[model samples]
Target chain A: MERSIRSYSPKDTHKIGRRIGTKAQSGDVLLLVGDLGAGKTTLTQGILWGLGGTEYARSPTFVLVNEYPARLTLYHMDLYRLNSIEEIEDLGLDDYLYGNDLCVVEWADKAPGYFPVNHAVVQLEVIDDQTRRVTVSSETAHLDRLVMAIAGGADE
Target chain B: MSDQDIALAIDTSTRYAVVGVSRDGQSIAELSWRSDRNHSVELVPAIQRTLAQAHVSIEDITVIHIAIGPGAFSALRVGMSTAMAMATGRDIPIITIGTLEIEVHPYLDLGQDVTAIIGAGRTRLYIGTFKREDSLSNGHVYLEDRDKFLENLPVDSIFCGEAVAELRSELIGRLGPDYKIVSAPPPTRSASVMAEIGHAKLKSGDTTDLADIEPIYLRSSQVASAARRWPNTKTE
Candidate 1:
């Protein structure tokens, strides 16, 4: 169903994201949803850090996708500026989506029709200047471990 | 000279797939399998079983040959990436050939120009034409649109490839009296042909740098270019 976690600071938010990143595996699709300046990019940076990615996690807003060399390839996509479904399909996203790596998409609400039937969604809300409430949900059991990893620690 | 000097060839350039082993210009084992679109899953196991049947281990492979293709992009990637990994790990030499070249090889010395065509997708074909004389020398395969290629067919050229059968009616309909449409004969032994070519190349020291191997895709993926089209947009 859904699980909620509260982060009092940026570090706490990063820690949670990093935990999920460490636990991520091939064919895992992460849907990040939030408003502007809602710490989405910061959470993604933490995810990349945990994945052993060497490059700085840059916003893929204009480019749509940023690929990083990691223990497993990291495909970070931003659907904020993608206007139409045809444009999104023309990108041939299946090559990266079905690939044997982790795929993280920001502002995924723009292209909901093309999303896989099973995926994990993370919703971030700004409670205050320094606080954020994150909710994670999925239909599959694999998401339980990811949410648990984010709530507890990566070790357990 | 022996099992230690054996070479392995893998081709997933088309729907029909093959894994073969050769030594000193002689094919030791040629394994053919059917795949709809599961190259990634079937390829490794096919290699393992084929090598085992040939009584050769991965350690005995001295060279890895693959078809760096102008075929299906995903299939070509699976073949090239796998071959590169295998060659890199063992420090073995690699020989790269075009997928169309494999189809054109059997008819290379037939004293006629040849155009190899493979199904790219619905209503489109990956067609490459080569002058047999030129193919034997500084090989240059040209990828062109199917309709354009048919309209510009040269006189006395022989057309052949795995997809030739399916396109036979279309070819006959488009061609004139001077052109000859020769559909590729059944029992496609493309993998064997690949191994033979590879062995010949290896003896002549025409191996490819493993780092420089890449698939020849005629159509662009367009993701990067599309993204760059709107750089001034405010996105967060």
Candidate 2:
């Protein structure tokens, strides 16, 4: 399933992220794909906060991944500098990838082979300086509801 | 100690740049530091300090032992090239050991089957299993893939090595309360253990040809340059 939503400002983006986070459950792998500074980190922060996390979510570019404890555990990973399947495998990612946590991966293209079939992907494109067009697609049916919630909730 | 009994060993795999010197099967000196991407700068100096501390000169060294990797690519290259260069025309033998085995050796006699794993960086691992010999000699080692490694694990097995810290919870959860998990010592300690192994190999005349040595990389590198989009700049 696929849903395309537009956000004219950072607030709009955060609202969309919050809605998805609110609906997120265990064993959800969320792939966020976008260019640099396309609000990936901001959306992640919004999602984490919306999930009732006390600490702020930061881009895990240098550390590779960061874990957050909320109503659901969030595993946030950034793969910008990772270019190889070997590099990704050596990271011991399978220990978390298969676990019952909410995983959000940035630059999910770096290790495209590892993402499971039931995951959702959000492609955020910079339509203008402040506007972004996010296309949410997933093979799992529940993620369609997530996309719907994000699209509909943001307008309210 | 005789000059011929001095063995110098270096391991740059993983994040540690470690050097060890042993004489007559006994560890004499060791030095290591977290290289954190500074392998070339830190390794030679660390080796120099370790040899000096051991009261042995480079010219007196009879064997060069290296932990040829299933490790970081650049670090493994640095260690192999350095060891080869140090042994060139010096009549010194160079012996190589797998990095995973180095991590697995210390726990062989714990009376349990052992699973040693090192990170291979994707969602994969370079894993090996060992069963101690009846004479208390080191176990036979076999490298296995992560999924298969997990599937075929023996009951009451002990999981150890460089990658275990990240998987401690998962392994315990999977194997239940009966299994044991322990972290191996840092690279400096493992390099010393490797030196002892190399010394044994030296006494037994088990060694590698200096020219034929290579790192024990089970997986090939995955890097490739992007395809060209423009036509050739030079015309025929």
What does candidate 2's lDDT look like per residue over A16-107, in tens digits?
Answer: 88888898887778999898888898888878887888788888999999999998999999978776665775675654664567889998
**Collision count for each candidate, in order:** 0, 11
Regions more than 4 Å wrong, model 2: A1-156, B1-3, B134-152, B183-189, B220-236
> Which window of 10 residues has the lowest lDDT sum in candidate 2 chain A?
A109-118
Quote the positional error of residue B208 for candidate 2 in Å: 1.1
Candidate 2 — what's its lDDT?
Answer: 0.75
Candidate 1 docks at the CAPRI level of: incorrect
Encode model 1's per-residue lDDT on B1-236: one tens digit a residue. Answer: 35445889998876677898877657788787776579999999999998998898898898888988766667767878899999989888999988887887888888888877776653346766787668453555554446666677655778888778876787787775555777555334467788778877887889988767877755422333443453333333
Question: CA lDDT of A105 in candidate 1?
Answer: 94
